[model samples]
Target: MLNIVEGVRQYAKTDRLAVICGEESISYADVEKYSNILGNYLIDKFNSDIPTVIYGNKDVMILVAMIGSLKSGKAYVPIDTSSPAQRMKDIIETVQPEVIFNLSDKEIMLDSSVSKNVEILDKATLMNLMIEKSNTYDFEISREKWVDNDENSYILFTSGTTGKPKGVQISTYNLDSFSEWISPVLGIDGSEMVVLDQPSYSFDLSVSTLYPGIIFGATLFSIPNSLILDFKKLYAELKKSNIKVWVSTPSFANMCLNDETFSQELLPELETMLFIGEVLPVPVAKELLDRFPRIKIINGYGPTEATVGISQVSINREHINANKSLPVGIPMPNSVIKIVNDEMEEVPKGEKGEIVIVGPSVSKGYYKNPEITNKSFYVEGESIFKEKSPVSALDEKLRLRAYKTGDLGSIDDDGNIRFFGRKDFQIKLNGYRIEIEDIENNLRKINEISSAVVLPINKNGEVSHLKAIVVLKKGINESKLKKTVEIKRELSKLIPKYMIPRSFDFIDEMPLNTNGKIDRKKLYADIVEEA
Candidate 1:
């Protein structure tokens, strides 16, 4: 893996573009210089070593702040401006950041939920420090302060089975392991190339582009929320952005496919398209192949806890021609894919079981939630992962981190890995891993709701959107339309917009199984399957 901070500094020796968002762009020289300056400022301003929070949407400051935090040996948490105020508050409470960079145009108005001393540097203030305080270049940050080993590279707060979000801490060691594998696998030659980074910075999918883009000196062409909402501007921007390697969800690609101009002529330099964070439909893969005969379509699979993706397969014409399901391919050089049964024992070949990913890229675990972390992630020592020593036993830290993905899959005799559905109520919608109970818990919080159940609405073997069923308290007279509008309006405040249900059903009573658990299968049959 490329030593990201040092790698960028080495690349900064030359005059090259590092990031380009809409009309705005930042150079590698500036990225190195400014991030160093910010690092110094952070070290000086706050004596504490707590993580920093960056609040923005598709801005260059966010990138600088990220590297700056990395340089100062502090992990950074990126919060998208699209996040609801409550969610933002929840994250701030979790990290308790000493300083937060407000690169967005909007004001970050936090109530009593956050500490009053959390310093916020707006776009203007941050630029003033970076530009006006260039004389402080003499105060270079020493490599001793640079992040390494088990220290968190960055913390990503994802949806938890519990109502609140759980932050996944990816250590520097994990990032290094992932970078080493992803670089060679993708054949990134460390030259200047523009890569499309369309996902929101808050999303784990962004890491695929963010770190690699910086390491290889690729120009990250970011697509902001504004452009994503308007097709005309998006197409116009796509025509302008000479992105070579494409990185995004299948849904985003499918949206672009709606435009006839999205073809070889639109992005002639585009050669590779890496799809992660969601299931890539065969039809979508086939469409890209039909459009670009020479394009390399790589389908990757892993949870954010596994450092982006642990396995990838380059899709070819044969797979599409045969009308076969895409395989996620084999694990990386340092990782192994295993299928475990109910007893936590390895399953037989070709048999479906819960997929467990064991590798160096596996995250330490969920932050501030030890109970759930213990339930999901663990460490293992064996010949495959044991650190060899002529003297005696290997160091415990050298063992492999194994994550029970809670996802079901099977490995073929040829070492090919196929993904089945999830083992639990968690489902992937539009690339976000949503725990069904997370939404249900939030729904049950509604004053009028006595009981609530949420289930995924599947279409064409993909989770289209969430559909929720709720039973209001008796005598709460309200029309379905009025109640739904009111409920969604309330839900929007409690969770991210993507987690909110697109459709709702009012039920007379909550169905239960023999064990008195919510009969989700019955609700699915009545609400999603039957409908």
Candidate 2:
């Protein structure tokens, strides 16, 4: 985990460039000064044994403090400073950080449960404290690994859209394999500077923001918080920087493709667009291809449990036509993917089964819940044991417990895994059961669309109907756009008649939650109010 920091230590010996953001340009040497000061402070205060919560966006201080805390023998929990007060409070209370490094003074107003016992260090106070303390601390640079390989490096709280949030305990070993697998796929290199658009705390997308950029020593550029909502402003800011790689979710990329001002003229510097976090609609992929035909658009797929992405495939027009559902492609090197039946036996090719991934990137389990831990994690052959037969217990114990992915998929004869949809997201509507993702995927085949999301919404009549909210590509007309509803008409030929969305709502923007998922609850409320 300190590999990134140590790399900075090696190349950043002089005052060469390191990090750049709004109103801040710091040298490599300057970063180490702050990192060392913060490292010393953490070593003196926490002694590298307890967990500390680091709350902030992509600030230089947060990066420095993270390295310093880990090098000093403490794990850090990154809180999304942008999250709601209640959500942030819940995370702080759960983690119960012995010490916290935050960027704001208002965080002092956190729940009384946390505000009382937690040691708080705001950025201003922490920077002043670092300035006051002499940087003369011995640089023995303890080769000692402050965090064990399996120990929790960070406690990431899920988006919690399902219910109460669960903390995902990620280990140093998790990150190590993650970086190793993703680095080669992304084609990272020294000259390939990328922008950090997502906040550090958002789980899966963080790999795009942090790991690849640092591993290849590429420069990282950050956008101002105010411009995040404005496509025109964001495009202007992006064009101002010499960014070559743009890594973000398909939603953000679609927004760019749909905006009139966002063309090759503005984003000429961008060459690679790495998309993850959600499915990439085919139309959005085509729009990007239409503009930057030479640019490589990577569609990466994986759940957070698999450490960002285990499978990826480059998008092209021919590949999109070859299959209704885009193949997630082959697993990364040294990683194995197995499709097993309900009985835990390997299923035949082209049969849908639970996707069980085994690799170093898999997390240990959810924190503090052994019941869930045992259910999700267990020896593979334990269920097959015959006590009377006297099978070797040791052999069974060494068998790998395949992580039961909630996702359902199938592998073709060539071993290309195709994601069908989430097992839970499938629901019955009218006389038919449907996978909501399938309708969304079909709607994406339209040429004028940028993206689409489908969900069942309840009407005032107390009946649920399929409703699709669509975001269109640039220059699509409301009159002509409604004509593009023919895509759904075409979809009727493919899917069951009951699966079609009864009504289509065209919107300038889709509501997104803090974690970058479609805010279906909010979308439902908005449609009802409009009705």
Candidate 3:
């Protein structure tokens, strides 16, 4: 179970730098040394399965804390300190962690009844402890003494836009499967100076930023949260390093492409631009490909349950047309993808339905909620006089658990999956059924537009209207654009009449969530209050 960390310790004997944060860089030997000290401290402080929370920005201390907690046979819950205070409080209360690890000394008031005994340790104290015990402890956890694969390694909470956030428990097996498949898929070797810009406590992307770097002896670059939105500063800082891979959300990719100077200078060195989390818009895809022809732009897809991404597709000029979206391509080797309807029946080729993923990379279940855990996650037909599944049986086709991704999709005859909007997000209006994304896609497909978002308006038990917010290309004017109402006429040919937005509001920019997702709720509020 802890073989991942053990591998790092073994690989540390060579002359290599393991982690590279802002001003400080640590060698592989130092990583092993620091992690040993921290792991020992954690083992001494808490008994097995005691909950813990790691706070603050991505740094060596955060990495050590994660590894240390896992080494002590406990699941570490990651709380993004940047999240709303109310949300953070709710998570801390629910988890009831024994310790709160913070690098920035961020304080949170806890309820006395359940969480009064929580211990707080800032980054300075951790670093001082590491220095004080420098390379002193000889830690040993042999392969013979392996912890069970079922033991949870980390609990990552998803943003609960639909309900209160639930912690998704990912085990050592999930990490191993992901690292095995994804590392080779990206052609990750040890030499690349990959930037760890994504928050460390986030899903598999955080794992992607860390594990592969350690496995290959590559230098991991850490970016502070404060610097993510400062595009100029970020690009300038990135230019200083010979970074080969740039991993981030599509919005960040769009931002970099929009900056003319960054496109001309900094992007040349970036060999792989990996976009995950949201739909990889065609406009941004085209711009990235046009500017950096040599760079491989991979559009990968998966929910948190799939351990980062289970499928990947690389975008090229010939494959994409003006009218179509790039398919998310094929499943990664060892992953089985099925597009099924409500009846759990498979959909035919080219027909869209819910995407259900079954693979070794899938997580166990939600933490401490058996009702959800049982309903959503289960080993089918296994309870009928069955034996335990062997590690070698990962590829064996038996009745195993599958994650019902609420995401809607269809696999073409060629096995490429095309993503539609979410099953919940789709709407029907008047006499016509519609996908809001279809309308938004048509609006942005026009050469005159740069960005577009579609929202459905409901009033008293009826989906009565469709609203669109758009940003025009640099030279287009709203007055002249008003003459393009016929544009909707063209859009109606592609989408249903009800799907064509009745009203169009031009804007300078589309508002985005902190995670770089389109904040449709915010857009709706702005349109209602102002328009």
Top TM-score hit = 1
Q: Runs in model 2 with CA error above 4 Å? A: 14-16, 136-140, 159-162, 379-401, 425-531
Write the number of the candidate with greater TM-score, choosing between 1 and 3.
Answer: 1
Provide C-alpha RMSD values for all models, in order: 2.2, 12.0, 11.5
TM-score list, all predictions = 0.96, 0.74, 0.76
User: What digit string (tens of lDDT, one per residue) describes model 1 on residues 1-531?
Assistant: 456787678788888888888889999888888999988887777756699999988987688898899888899998898888778888999998889999888998877767899899998998889777788742558888988777888899988777888999988778777787777666566877888878988898888877777787878898899889999999899888888888899999998999889999999888788988889999999999988887889999989999898899899878777665788888987677889998889999999999998877888898888998999998876765544433212223533788999999999887888887789988898999999988988888788889988878778777888888889888348788888999999988889999999988887898899999988888877763465
Worst 10 residues of 3 by lDDT: 380-389
Structure candidate 3, residue pairs in collision: none
RMSD (Cα, Å) of model 3: 11.5
Better of 2 and 3 by TM-score: 3
The lDDT, on a scale of 0 to 1, for candidate 3 is: 0.68
Predicted candidate 3 versus true structure: per-residue lDDT over 143-246, tens digit per residue:
33233365677888753322245678887777777777667656676564554455445444667657666666667777777666787777767777666776
- Candidate 2, 307-351: lDDT as tens digits: 677777777888767656566777775456778888878898899
Best candidate (score: lDDT): 1
lDDT of each: 0.84, 0.66, 0.68
lDDT of 3 at 395: 34
